[model samples]
Target: MNPCRPEEPPTVGVEEEYFLVHPGSRAVVPASARVVARASAALGEDVAGEFTEFQVEGRTQPCSGARELRAELCRVRTALADAARAEGLRLCASGTPVIADADADVSGDRSGDSTLTYISDHPRYRAGVLQYRSMLDDFAVCAFHAHVHLPDRETAVLTCNHLRPWLPLLVAMSANSPYHRGRDTGYAGWRAVIRSRFPCLGPPPYAASLAEHERLATAMAATEAMLDPGMPFWDVRPNPHLPTLEVRAMDVLPDVADTVALTLLIRALVATAASRAAAGDPGPRTGAELLRAAYWRAARDGWPGHGADPLTGRVLPYAVQAQKLVGHVRPALRAYGDEDEVTAFLDRLASRGPGAERQRARMAAEGRLSAVVDGLVRETCPDR
Candidate 1:
């Protein structure tokens, strides 16, 4: 049914995208090339370019435990932040930058900031710009991507198939991109909607066997509709460069600890699904159309808001879905020794709410998106 047989425990890695901004004004700035040059010189290849010149990404080596992953994230964030500061810019790690349109106009009018205009200078990125044009321009959003190693392509497909239903709940938990183009976008995670604009995005079709998976994917790839195999842009997919299943649903979290927490949950989910597969149990049978609708609900109204349960299709409070998810993954959490940390993290998140809520709270109280940016800058790097 699956391609790869059991091998060893999977490793975890994280790739986080950040906004390069003026520390004083909190405006997104197109200084990533300079910052990346400095960061790569000091921190090596883990620091790299994103879709646009206003964004930079940091990746970590495959790690075994949450503690190890946490330490690496802390180091990577510190190094990148330092690199940005050295270039007279700051790196803010959130799903979307909080720069008001007025600030962009001022910077654009003054220095030709090109905050929203400059695409990354890579060949593929340029190709994408030429091909997508306006669609590409509308997508300056960022996200936190997590990769969980699978034994081989077969297992990767299995994990991705099984993980489909969980995508919406995770999106709700990671919702952070409420503001876009300087105003509230009316969606908790606007990045999700923007990303779904790609023809090859959203949930992949279920593959009864590895042969079916390969056939479907090959056919799609042959059309050249997408940039590449990885371009499908499904919320979860087999990594193009590694033997892993990458989860891309979660928006970039403001806190490094929260990032690690979500990473742990992702790994646990994969492990749990793999075990079920081993026992000859297929995962949830949610239809692709329903999955799409559920994702839309989560993106439009994250956390505590009503969302359709992927398993039952019943509209329920997000809190109910979250609890059910935790219960479903309890065995994996226990096996991975992540139960305590995850429980605490969930409690904290529920107490304060997702980044979108926090941002709106700041806006409501201060009546200024600038203040939201100020708070984001302070919380971008873990206290060090």
Candidate 2:
């Protein structure tokens, strides 16, 4: 297949995960089964269960542009929120749960042990819980994934290389998890911190070819680092079953506008990268260690904080790097007719700060984590 042309931009799809929380206490509630059933009746297959019962995922069909994507996002989110309300729970789009019943003994047999009770009954999730143990205890974190169509597996692998240098910026831009387990974790995106505990965490390794990527994935599976080659858990990767590059570096955003903005930016980034690769650009050969450091810093400080440029080893404010990313992908954005919308979103981010900063401000004003959760719930499905 030929690479995606500038005039014919690739279709994009998005998957967003959300939390079900108590209305007054804001504690995560394990009600996904009921909620998903109710929501699926309205949204059909777009609504599904996640690893834990406290979480639910909504997927959008492939969309040609930001406007269509935004409509789908709003529809699914509104449906899920209404379903949660029907189940006497509120929907939250934050990356981490603000509060949880950490000590509740859900299993009648296991006294004082609520470890595996929250996990969904799916075999895959059960296996993950048994293998990872305590790692799944507080694993209610949610993320936003954008799938950008590519010509083929080879092109998608190459595009992953092109996307490495910018992954940290995406992380910082979507930082939403400021508090976890009922208290501030002192990090911008605590969800990133929790995810770092996984064996295949951070940006994926650079692979010169599809064969090399397969070799690495096979080795990781052999080591039991992940369940299989299909589950690398990297920030970005070529989808194992789809003809698209899936970016999983971002947190689930509260606002649909932010979600649409990020999705447009990701589509532009993929288009620009694939175009460069078609023109014989091998993409930046950033070292894995440098990229790891950059990701950690981005997760720690978020935007307006110092961020390291993995390509140059130069540390700059995240806002500077964000502008540079916009400049880098300006041509593609313009080609997709997303320049104005994306620029306006960035301006709004600059003025009001990303979700993490806004969350922290709300915490300060209300002096309560529940208030922050309230704000997130309000922002999550404002249309409903």
Clashes of 2: 0
As for candidate 1, its clashing pairs are: 3-154
Predicted candidate 2 versus true structure: per-residue lDDT over 251-318, tens digit per residue: 99998998998889998888888888877788899998888889899999998699899978999988
Best-fitting candidate, scored by TM-score: 2
RMSD of each: 3.6, 2.0
- Give TM per candidate: 0.91, 0.96
Per-residue lDDT over 214-300 for candidate 1, one digit per residue giving the tens place of the 0 to 100 score: 677677767754666544566777777787888988898888888888898888888778766666666677898889899899999
Off by over 4 Å in 2: 1-4, 104-115
- Model 1 C-alpha lDDT versus the unseen true structure: 0.79
Whole-model lDDT per candidate: 0.79, 0.86
Q: After superposition, how far is residue 93 of candidate 2 from its true place, in Å?
A: 0.6
Q: After superposition, how far is residue 219 of candidate 2 from its true place, in Å?
A: 0.3
